[model samples]
Target chain A: DTAVSQTPKYLVTQMGNDKSIKCEQNLGHDTMYWYKQDSKKFLKIMFSYNNKELIINETVPNRFSPKSPDKAHLNLHINSLELGDSAVYFCASSQDLDGADTQYFGPGTRLTVL
Target chain B: DQQVKQNSPSLSVQEGRISILNCDYTNSMFDYFLWYKKYPAEGPTFLISISSIKDKNEDGRFTVFLNKSAKHLSLHIVPSQPGDSAVYFCAASGFFQGAQKLVFGQGTRLTINP
Candidate 1:
């Protein structure tokens, strides 16, 4: 069974366009996170939600927002997309907020802002 | 500043041989570390992990070694096979803003030649 899944494996859009990526996990995890992998292959955390509440925001631009409808779902919405936003976005989940918990990652969405 | 670093961008190994990947971290607050493997067009899958208290952890063909004093870690794979070829990422975990956060390195691609 797929533990974590993301929709739209690939996304292409123009500058100033708005886009959203959806994620879901069946692992019954309490914490979920969004990460971005840039052209340099540096994967950095952008946001984290615990039990549907915002917990970590890693100084990402205000144009990016994350929403969690429930414990199993977390979605990312990017407004006014820029070329620098072209990267792979990954969603992850862990059993809890414990620092030692193992995180399961989604297949990732390749976002290309032209 | 990059917290986690994997200096090698790629590594090649012969099948049935051993493969070793190294990682370094600058943060002393990190107490947990993990290794993940990712193939093209796929998300990263958890390989192994080690706690700061432990010097080493092994699971089947995969073993992870941690050195808290030097803030360095390494992953060793024995009897490497062609299937083991992929991009390997090292991640450090810590608690921030009451949430667990992961800092990932720029991955190192491994190619196992049969």
Candidate 2:
């Protein structure tokens, strides 16, 4: 069984279009996170939520937003997507807000903005 | 600024040989560190972790060594196999903005040749 899963595994769209990626975890974790992996293979954290409350927000652009409906789910929405936004986005979860805990990651959603 | 860094972009090792991956960090406050492995088209999987309090932790064929004085850590895989070929990322967790967050490295691609 998949502990963490994401939808829209591959997305291709034109610039200026908006898109949303969904994530879910069956591990019943308390904390969820959104990370983006750029072309150079740099994985950077964008947002983190604990128990449905926003906890960590990085220096990401205002066009990107993360929403966690519940502890099992965290979704990312991008507005006016740019070519720079073409990267693999990953969803992860941990047992708690502790960063030391092992975070399980989803398969990832590859977003491509033409 | 990038707090975590992996100097090597790639490493090649033969099967039955040992593979070593190195990482460095600029932040002294990081109390915990982790290693992650990612194959193509898959999300990163937690490999091993070490607490700054200790110097080394070993599990199965994988061992992690930490040198807090030099702010360096390394992952050694004994008897490397083809299945072990993947991208390795080093991450550090520490208090930042009143919360604990993980800072990831640029990642090192490990290739085990048969």
Candidate 3:
């Protein structure tokens, strides 16, 4: 079974457009995270939610927002997307907030902002 | 500043040989370390991990070594097979903004040849 899944494997939109990526996990995890892999292949965490409560919010731009309606779902919405936003976005989930817990990641969504 | 770093961008190993991947970190607060493997068009999967208290962890043919004094870690794969060819990422876990967060390296692509 796919423990973590993401919608729209690829997204291409013009500049200033808005887009949303949906993620879901069936591992019954309590924490979900959003990460971005830039052109340099640096994977950085953007936000994290635990039990539908915002827990970790990195120094990301305000244009990006993460929403977790439940423990199993976490979505990322970007407004006024720019060319710099072209990268791969990944969704991950873990059992809890423990540092030793292993996190499972989704296939990732490649976003191209033209 | 990048807390976790994988200096090697790629490594090649002959089939049935051992493959060693190295990683270093600058953050002393990181108590947990993990290695993840990713194939093209797929998400990263957990491979092995080691905690700060332990110097080595072994799982089958894969072993992880942690040196807390040097803030370094390594993953060794014995008798690596062709299927082991993938991108390997090193991650460090620590508290950030009052929540446990994982910081990942740029990844090192491993190519196993027969």
Please tell me which predicted candidate would have the highest lDDT against the true structure.
3
lDDT of 2 by residue, B1-114 (tens): 889999999999999999999999999999999999999999999999999999999999999999998999999999899999999999999988988899899999999999
Q: Which stretches of candidate 3 lie over 4 Å from their true place?
A: none
lDDT (Cα, tens digit) per residue for candidate 3, span A34-62: 99999999899999999999998898999
Q: Estimate each model's TM-score.
A: 0.98, 0.98, 0.99
Error in Å for residue A50 of model 1: 0.6
> Model 3 chain B: which ten-residue window has the lowest total lDDT?
B92-101
lDDT of 2 at A21: 98
**What overall lDDT goes with each candidate model?**
0.95, 0.95, 0.96
**What residue runs in model 2 are displaced by over 4 Å at the alpha carbon?**
none
Q: Weakest 10 consecutive residues, lDDT, candidate 2 chain A?
A: A97-106
Give the alpha carbon lDDT tens digit for every residue of B51-96 in model 3: 8999999999999999999999999999899999999999999986
Question: Tens-digit lDDT track for model 1 on B1-114?
Answer: 999999999999999999999999999989899999999999999989898999999999999999898889999999899999999999999876676789999999999999
Model 3: lDDT of residue A7:
94
Residue A79: error of model 3 in Å? 0.2
Clashing pairs in 1: none
Q: What share of the true interface contacts does each candidate keep?
A: 0.90, 0.80, 0.98
Per-residue error for B112 in candidate 3, Å, reads 0.4
